[model samples]
Target: MSAELRRELSRLDTLANALDSQFRIPGIGMRIGWDGILGLVPGVGDAVTLLPAAYLLYKGHRLGARRMTLMQMALNSGIDLAIGAVPLLGDLFDIGFKANKRNVALLRRDIEARIEEVA
Candidate 1:
């Protein structure tokens, strides 16, 4: 991959980490991040989280991710938003789901496959 692409991927990885798994709960070996914390709020919390998710999708599109790959990313975020709007269960689900990480993984896989194809 080009240096720019590498940097972009790194950025996405960092963003995903921040959104999905930035902190570990003491003595529990479980990690969570802003996504889960924000999910604690009512309707606004889920909506707020959607902004970063949308940015992920937008960056994936700019990176030339395939249509199907983009769709999958959207689906992941959609699921996250839909289910993550619930009460306590949604926060738990957000912690476990890690949708941002999943989307980043999908974007990385798509980019790597494209690079392989070109090479």
Candidate 2:
């Protein structure tokens, strides 16, 4: 991958991870971000949070992240969004569940695994 692409993906991962961090989970809260406040507004916060994943999924598809891999990432987003739509449950789930973070991890792992295969 080119330096620019790496930087872009890194930034996206940071943002996604931040969204996942608003919770108090151990080993996860370090990435906490403003999703709590921003997400208070209806329709916008969730949309903002999901956008990065959508972009990443599109990019991943273009970059040839396998169909199943891409589906898993998409499924993560779907689950997050679905659960996040609930009243109190969504908020709690948002803080506890780090779908974006998980997706980033998945992507990174895929990258690493491919690299290993080459070696």
Candidate 3:
């Protein structure tokens, strides 16, 4: 991968980690992140967390991901948002769903596939 793409992937990875798996829960060793924490708030928490997810979509577009890949990424975010709007269950979903990390992984796979095709 080009240095620029590597850097972009690194940035996305950092954001995904922050959003989905930054902290480990005591005893059980379950990992949680700001997405789960913010989701605790009623009404607006899921919306608040969507900004970074949108950013991931934007970056995927800028990085030349395929249309279908972009759509899948958006779908992941949409599912997360739609389901994440629930009360307690939504918070639990956030801990497991991890839309941002999933998006980054999708984007990375798409980009890598495109690169391989060119080579």
Q: 1-119, model 1: which lDDT tens digit per residue?
A: 99999999999999999999999999998999999999999999999999999999999999999999999999999999999998999999999999999999999999999999999
Candidate 2 backbone collisions, by pair: none
lDDT of each: 0.97, 0.71, 0.94
TM-score of each: 0.98, 0.75, 0.98
List the candidate 2 regions with Cα displacement exceeding 4 Å. Answer: 1-9, 22-31, 34-36
lDDT of each residue in 24-113, candidate 3, tens digit only: 999989899998899999988899999999999999999999999999999999999988999999899999989999999999999999
Candidate 2 lDDT, tens digit per residue, 36-101? 445565777777777776877887776656677888999988987777777676766766677777
Error of 3 at 90 (Å): 0.8
> 2 or 3: which has the higher TM-score?
3
**Cα shift from native, residue 79, model 1 (Å):** 0.4
